[model samples]
Target: MKTFKSNVELVFNNLNSEKPSRNTIGILAIKERFETALPRSIPLNGYSLESHQKNEYSRWLKINTVATKFKNYKAVYISLKHPDRAPGDITAAEMRFVANIADHYSGGLVRTSHTQNLLLPLVHNSNLVSLWRELSSTNLSAANIDTMQDIICCPGFEFCSLANTTSIPIAHEIQNLFTDPDELQALGNIQIKISGCMNACGHHHIGHIGILGVDKKGEEWFQITLGGRADEKLQLGKRLGPAVDRASITSTVEVIIRHYLSERIDQQEHFLTTLDRIGIDSFKEAVYG
Candidate 1:
């Protein structure tokens, strides 16, 4: 029987091979190594591991394999906001720290999300509480997951030549505005995505409230879109009105949110659903008027 150490060695050897046999073979070899290194006793189907059970992990494969089962060795997610700029900037030391965390807690595996956050998907459940404390010390934790704070932003004028405005600062401003956790919770699951240009690398087209930066006569102007979604019920948001100056971006968002709050039938009604029911005309009036 191949020991876990030997299995890992074999996997690495195959990966490092100068002339790999075939892609499928390489994949199978790696999968075999993972399976051998972490064997599951119970069938993944209908056998739910307490640690693996979370609303966040629902969309991911629900298999209780050795790799997926975290009760004995749990996993956790950590989000780094504005991962591309400023405070979001990760230094080499921080990268090493993250690597160390994965090695010490999550068996040397790290995952990145489309939202640009790093995920430690296999940390031991026993170490979760302490792990959070450890991660918090290094400013690493999924603090903004499933909340409006988990903003998706693109590289704007700061780095991208195609960008018309600086998205990171705007994103920071929006995130800072809702510092009160309780108030943020009351706001519900709102998604605010920003794109530096019409390229939509930030996926602003699919955000519930999308902001696209446009250049008007060499000045930065932003166009707002309402009711867009990237979820199961995917739909493109409609344009609110004419572009607003960069200075009015935050205030414009505030106005839209205020309108949604005042007119929503109930607290449970989501912004998109409310907009769908009432139509975008009223939101347009609120923004323009």
Candidate 2:
């Protein structure tokens, strides 16, 4: 068995190994040259900790160390957390610290954003201590399931020129509305996605609750769709009604969720399952009503 110092090296070694013979020097050099260059800490980006092998993981301390290295660069940072597995473990303080460190190191500021992640852009190396202290006092340094915002959303029409509506604004509004910790915890593994157009860039096709925008007579109309999927069970969302106006979108979705709550047998019943058992016709009636 052999191990490569960096993930890149490991990839090259694997490629070379496919030639019916092992590149022994390549393997040895991988051990020699790149090992030290391997990030001492995990990079905050997804790549640094993304699972390369089964049950294998990067060291948290090392990941933390690597994060400091980028304290002051002009970059955007994003992260994902599995909140269903834990609750409120990551704190605003930890987020604040990451932002502070990013600002200090880069001479920029940290911004805790709607999408669940930390930002430390425009930070510089010289201000790492102050950034660290600021973050420490704010309580923003947890990395477990507890202290995470496990939100998933889409670009919608803002980036895509074809968008019929704006997914970002709706996503932001929904995120703000659902600020209650108890509400989030009760939602329990729910995934909400929105698309500005029927193209489904927001992956609304797969969201437990999906929103799609459509054009009607030069006016923005949104379709409330249901029961679309992409995983092992692939399905497309069915339109619940003719497109409604922008102002009504959130209210319509709320009505649908309220319907689900009324019919759900227990807290464990997820959005999809509730939709499944109740049938879309029920949602259609409620939406149209």
User: Which candidate leads in lDDT?
Assistant: 1
- lDDT over C-alpha atoms for residue 277 of model 1: 91
Q: Listing every candidate in turn, what is its Cα RMSD in Å to the true structure after a full C-alpha superposition?
A: 11.2, 12.1
- The Cα local distance difference test for each model comes to 0.73, 0.56
Clashes of 1: 4
> Which numbered prediction scores highest in TM-score against the true structure?
1
Candidate 2 lowest-lDDT run of ten = 53-62
lDDT at 154, model 1: 87
* lDDT tens digits, residue span 134-186, model 2: 44354443222111134344555666788777766666555555545456556
